[model samples]
Target chain A: MTGWLSIFKREFRAYFATPLAYVFIVIFLVLSGVFTFFVGGFYERGQADLLPFFAYLPWLYLFLIPAVAMRLWAEERKSGTLELLMTLPIGISGAVVGKFLAAWAFTAVALGLTFPLVITVNFLGSPDNGAIVSGYLGALLMAGAYLGIGAAVSATTKNQVVAFVLSVTVCFLFTVSGLEIVQAFFPDAVGKEVAKFSFLTRFNDISRGVLDLRDVIYFATLIGFWLFLNRLFLDNAREAG
Target chain B: MAPRLEARSLVKRFGPITAVDHISLKVEAGEVLGFLGPNGAGKTTTMKMLTGFLDPSEGEAYVGGVSVADDPERAKRQIGYLPEGAPAYGDMTPRGFLTFAAETRGLTGAARDAAVARAVHALSLDRVIDQTIETLSKGFRRRVGLAQAILHDPDVLILDEPTDGLDPNQKHDVRNLIDGMRKDKAIIVSTHILEEVEAVCTRVVLIDRGRIVFDGTPAEFRGRAEGAGTLRVILPADAVEDAVEQFEDLDEVSAMDRHPTPDGRVRFTLTGDDRIALINRVTGVIDGAGWPADELELDAGRLDEVFRALTSRETDHQDSNQGQEVRA
Candidate 1:
């Protein structure tokens, strides 16, 4: 109905316009199955839940979601479509938000395709469906956070590979902030504070069946901050003068 | 009536270098102003600022009387811009791209459908409407970009080199498209092609190094040439010596050159500071000498020469290199 919505529609369709969407979905489904069955040992653990499936999502998205977000602004700039898009009567924020929302929804679709996992877990045993939903919601929010960072980084350069590599590095730091290897570099107080920001730490609680209000608020704030940076970066992305 | 598109003292600076400096002009409805300049003359940068794609370091651009900086959305709504290179979504089909462009401009339902249909028809894109933009020929791709720009029929149309990179027939078709729309919208076309300016523009604004050097009608622009008012004549070989003697006696004739033709005729070019007086004197001398002139013609001046004279040549290499690097 409005500008962002139209932008959203076009960008949402753009994902499927190329092989990017199907390829991403297939890769996601295959790796998801492999990670859950072979590595996480969904069967060997004797657990009837999808915990192992959800456990490997962050790592999978660390590489995969950036692939989606890498093309968001990078391709627009590379193809010179940014000139056309920016000249339209839409707000810069609208364009940024629209593309982000499209990427988020597309990733959600891939996450939704894991319905077989949901059905498989349900058929095997009586698992806590509510916690599973919460886990799914948490995964979606975390992906959005990763996407937010990737979009901002993509806005910084027209090169998609640079966007992808930089986004992976940045996302990696955020994912590992709570690990002891990273904690050794900071003072105890700063180390504890930094640990609170880790995707692994925040997600650990939410995936365990407790949707903490603080965790949700944290993800929301992180997304907002990065998207705000994305808008700023896009404005500067136009060749100066 | 107020001009449909106007810029007031527009200036854009990338750091210390002034890309567009104190540029100002206005285009009323029914006037197609040709923005003529070389590659690095800041034509594209000015168009970008005017279209609200880039902010000016100083000054303002207005569309339908609404300031681009103050009310960009409203001003932009009245503008249809075809940016340089005619960039469009490569993955999108022409049909989808046009629909998306129309919808983004807030055209919906019947209006949107009608707009897209009209643009498709106008650009003759019916055949390629279903093809992805990347797969279409360059001409078709450019037409798709044009269709997207005109989808809303905004009051002001700013096209950056609409015919660039097209074959001659494609160039002709694109000019016809611009000509057909000239009467309804105030259009500004930036091009280095001198022939295109005469083909579609009602007026010419020549800028060089971010400054307006000449702004006038095409004839007036051409009148700036060194030999604009010169006269040329062909005399039979038997009468050439007599005509040369008579021409030298006239006070108005400042210089003259005789060129011998292979057909046993001698051609003479007469130049003077005062065109009207010189024409009168030259004719009197020819009549008095009773010279049989085979052909006599007045030179209207060469557009290429005029273009070169008005625009400085030294700015070519360095500025063009900088312009390309600055564009993307």
Candidate 2:
């Protein structure tokens, strides 16, 4: 736990030490606001819930989360600092957990900044706060899942752009699994199975004022599975070098 | 005392290229061992294996008797490694980077702060600790790297070219710092500069083409090329063979070389570590042989010559072996 916390602190401070965190937060806020109010027609829909805001989150994170997590290990490898970190006393798992938590927390901070939208909705209408709270919870969990994949991809290469593009491509696959065009490629039963495994479907279930135990386990399991792969990648690189 | 660091039959290969080929070495505590090799000589590869950054394809490396492959974390706890290029996050300042290293080493609260302070003070990074690493000079960046490596005060330090790009003053200070920590730790420093090794290293392991050709103290290494007692006599051109015959009875002067100069004088070169004895015998022979010589001097052995001889022979042997393999 201490090892993880130490890595987390280093990673968190690393974001602030440069212009990355501020730039990410600013871009995230402006885009989320623009997408929710203008693009998704939040005011036009006139819904009492945060449907417009939550709907754009998965898409926004697809690009923005990769931007944040792309450099986590890729930059370390490019700069040859990965060897320095790997030679430390901490295990590879600890380093992965530490880095993943830091990036996830940074994304949470970006998520938290959008609370004004919650406040704005609460003041103007009698929206169900339970659903809004669950929507935010789902957003946070989905971020962890996406960032876990991003972190795993980041460990595979020294090129940040390569890491970013590969992760975004993979995340896109998981996001569109439930869509009709994607499901059409599979047989009827397999298509249904693919749709059921889609990230959008599971995330949408929680955003609809329903926090199912299965959704929680799904996202957590996905995150854990990717994190395990991240560790394995790190171990392989350490041995290979 | 047991060796502070040891590698037994360590081997590493990348596809067909073997970087470190079943090399073994040991350094006792308080010894500054120089790792000498040319570029592409697998010096850095050996250090990485020792530091547990790269697992050996076969065999094992140990720090304080803990196997790097089996128990890397425990072994690494006793090691401080400064890799080539001394890479660190450019976004982080020295203070922030050192603090991160401290925290990773499990130092916390007051202890962490104290460790950071001590490292900063030791490296004299007062003015630059707050500046981003990207803005610092090469010397200051090297110091920051040194600071982090020593912050934990590990018992084994595996440094790859620690003073590669430093100014003379910075190099002196770094050498002194490593020397001062010698009694408490074992330091293995690799460098291309022979003077740096001569200044600080107590022993040296001269590696050539992934093999250790020489492993001994500095003085012992210099003593290798001392040849069969051969003497050169300097005399007038006509008296060369007479001077040589005069020294033939001396057992210490087993062989002789008398080369005639353009100026009509013969110059003799002597080969032997016992210069005084050789000189005395030559003088006795010269006085008895009635040969008048203009000048005689002793030759100083150069490390550059030794390095060339060692690396070239190894490369030639490797090429011949490959040629034979192709023929087969």
Candidate 3:
């Protein structure tokens, strides 16, 4: 447990020590504002809610989450620090979980910075605060899911570019699985089954003022699954090396 | 009491290639074991398995009586490993990197701070402790890696090629550090630098083709050389044949060979069992002939000769086996 906390603290502070954290946060904030006001027509809709902001988040995350998670394992492997970290008196699972949590927490900080949007919605008119809270929970959970995939893919290679591209492609499949354009190619039965796996469908439920237990479970299980894969990949690499 | 570190029939295979064949050894406290091998000779692979960075395909490595294969975390707490190239997080300062290492080793608060301080002071890293590692020089980078490895004051220290790329002075400093620490910790360091074995290692393990070719004290290794004693006399190129002819007839000289140097000087090396008699006779022969010579000396045994003799014998054995296969 101490090992995990030590790694978490170092990994978390490492993000702020470099320019990556500041640059990523600024880009995320600007893109979120642009997507909400211009692309989603927040003012025109004037529904006194952040539905437009919540709707554009998955698309924004397809790129941003990979960027944040790409360096989790890839940088360590590339710099040869992976060997040092592995030889320490810590379980592989602990390091994996510590790194994942650090990336997830950083993403949450970025998400929290969008509090002005929540404040703006409430000041404009009477809005459902409960639904807004659910939306934030749903976004954080979705970020965890995306980060999990990115971290797992990052462990497979020492190149961050490869990790980023592979994570984006995999996350895109999850994001668009339930869309009519993708599901149209399959039969009705297979399409519904594939749609059941879509992150969009689960996130949509929570975004629409409904905190479904099934959605929460889906995100939790998805995060666990990918983190497991991350640990396995790293273990294999260590042995193979 | 159990050995501080032990490898019992440890093996690591990658599909068709066995990088580390069955190898076993032990290092008790207060010993610095020099792992000597040519490139790709499984030295690093063996160290990796012993440090719990890699799982063995067969067998086990124990640290402080705990099997790394069975409980790596427990074994790792007793080890401080400096992997090849002395890798560290290049973005972090040495202070931050050592702090992290100290913390991961289970140190905290004042203990952690004191550990980091000791490491920094020991490695002379105070000047560059706060500077990011990527910006540091190669020698300083290596020292930081060393500092991290010794931060927790582990019971065992495994360093792979720790002085590989450093200048002479830096190498001297590293050797001094190892000499200072060998009193309490069991240290294993791998290098092809034969002189290093003589300099710091209390014991030597020489491996070739993923097998232990020789294992003994450094003095024992030098004693294994083919020539018990050698008399070297540097003469003019034209006089070399004359010197060899004269030395071959002497009763004390067993074998003689003339090696022409690039500087137009011919050197004859005379090997024999009796060092005192051989030296006395060789000097008499050279003095009687009145042969103009630049230098003359006698060596008990040469390490370079021993290393080459051992490693080449393995290659020769392999070649003969392959030749037989081709004929059959």
Candidate 4:
């Protein structure tokens, strides 16, 4: 546990040690506001809920989370610090989880900064605070899933650009898997199965304040699955490098 | 009672190419083992395996009697490794990086502070402790890497080319530090610089083509050359041909060469198995001939000659093997 905490602290501090954290937060906040007000027409609907903001959470995270996670292992490998980290007394799983939690926490900080939307919704009309809290929870969980995938891809290459592009492409498939346009290409049975795996369906459930146990499990398992793959890839790289 | 570091037939293969062949050795406490090799001669690969950074394709490595493959985390607790180039986080200050290293090594509270302070003072990093690593000079950066490796003060230290790219003063400082620490730890330092072997190592292991070609003390290595205990006499140029003929005819002199010196003197070098007997016989001849000699000296075996002879011989053997395949 101490090893994990040490890595987590170093990784988290590393984010703010450079301009990456500030740049990412600024871009994420500005895009979230733009998409919510102009694209989703929050005021035009005149509703007292943050559904407009939640609607664009997955798409917003598609780019933002990868930017945060791309440097997690890619930079370590490029700088040759991966060898140093791996040779430490820490276990492989501890390092992977520590790095993933750091990136997830960074994204959560960016998500937390969007509190103005919650304030605006409450001022306009009576709102279900329970749903607002669940929406934030759902967004954070989904970010963990995206970051897990990004961290795994980042471990496969030393190039941050390659990690970014590959992660975005993979996340895109997960986001749009349930859409009618995508499901149309498959048979009805296979399409339903594919939709069952889509992050959109699960994220929407939490956004609506349902808080289904199964949806929570879905995101948790997805995060665990990708992080396991990340550990395997790193371990293999140590042998093959 | 057990060796602090040991390798049993460790090997690493990448596809069809064998990077590290089956090689084994051991180092006890208070011993400095110098690992010498030519380019791509498996020095770094062997170190990587011993440090648990790379898995060997065959055999195993142990630290303090613990197998690296069986429990790498436990085995790693006993090692402090400075990988090639001394890589570190560029964005981090020396203080931040050392703290992180200390924390990961399980030091905390006052202990962590003390360790970091000790490393800083030991490497003389106080000047750049708070500066970002990328902004520091190469010497400072290398020292920072060294500080991180020694933060935990493990029983085993594996350093690959630790003095590479450092100026003379910095190199001297690093060598002093290693010398100080060798009293309680088993140290393995891989280097290409021949003089480093004489400077610090208690035993030297020379590797060629992923194999141990020579292993011995510094003096023993120098003794391997046939040119050991040669006598050289500088006579006037006019007496060169006659002196060479007379020296060659002596029973003690096995071989002799004469070359014209820049100062119009003929330099004759005589080689034989026994130095005292050979010099006595040659002096007798010289006195009888009454040759006008400017200087007389004896030569110890040169290390550079032995190193070149050993490695180049391996290359020649490989070249001829390839030639035989081409003809067949």
Return the DockQ of model 3. 0.67
Error of 3 at B17 (Å): 1.1
Name every residue pair that clashes in candidate 2.
Answer: B232-B268, B232-B269, B233-B268
Error of 4 at A84 (Å): 0.5
Off by over 4 Å in 2: B226-299, B314-328
Clashes of each: 0, 3, 0, 0
lDDT (tens digit, per residue) of candidate 2 on B154-269: 89998888997899999999999998999978999999998887789999899876888889876556555444234455678787666666666666664556666888787877
Q: Provide per-model DockQ scores.
A: 0.66, 0.70, 0.67, 0.69
RMSD, model 3, all Cα superposed? 6.7
Candidate 3 chain A minimal-lDDT segment of 10 residues: A232-241
Q: Which run of 10 residues does model 2 chain A get worst, by summed lDDT?
A: A232-241
For candidate 2, report its TM-score: 0.87
- Candidate 4 off by > 4 Å: B229-300, B317-328
The better candidate by DockQ, 3 or 4, is 4
- The CA lDDT of each predicted structure is 0.89, 0.85, 0.90, 0.89
Put down candidate 1 lDDT per residue, B163-266, tens digits, no spaces: 87789988998899889998989999999899888788899999887899899888677668778768898888888777878889888888999999999899
lDDT of 3 by residue, B1-328 (tens): 8899999998888888788889999999899999998788899999999999988899999998999988889999999999999999888999999999998988989999999999999889999988999999999999999999999998999999999888998899899999999999999999989899989999999988688989988867876786656888899877777776888788888888877889989888888767668889988887888878777887768788888888886567668788565321
Best by lDDT: 3
TM-score of chain B of each: 0.80, 0.76, 0.77, 0.77
Q: Return the TM-score for each candidate structure.
A: 0.88, 0.87, 0.87, 0.88
Give the alpha carbon lDDT tens digit for every residue of A33-117 in model 3: 9999999999999699888899999999999999999999988888888999999998898999999999999999999999999
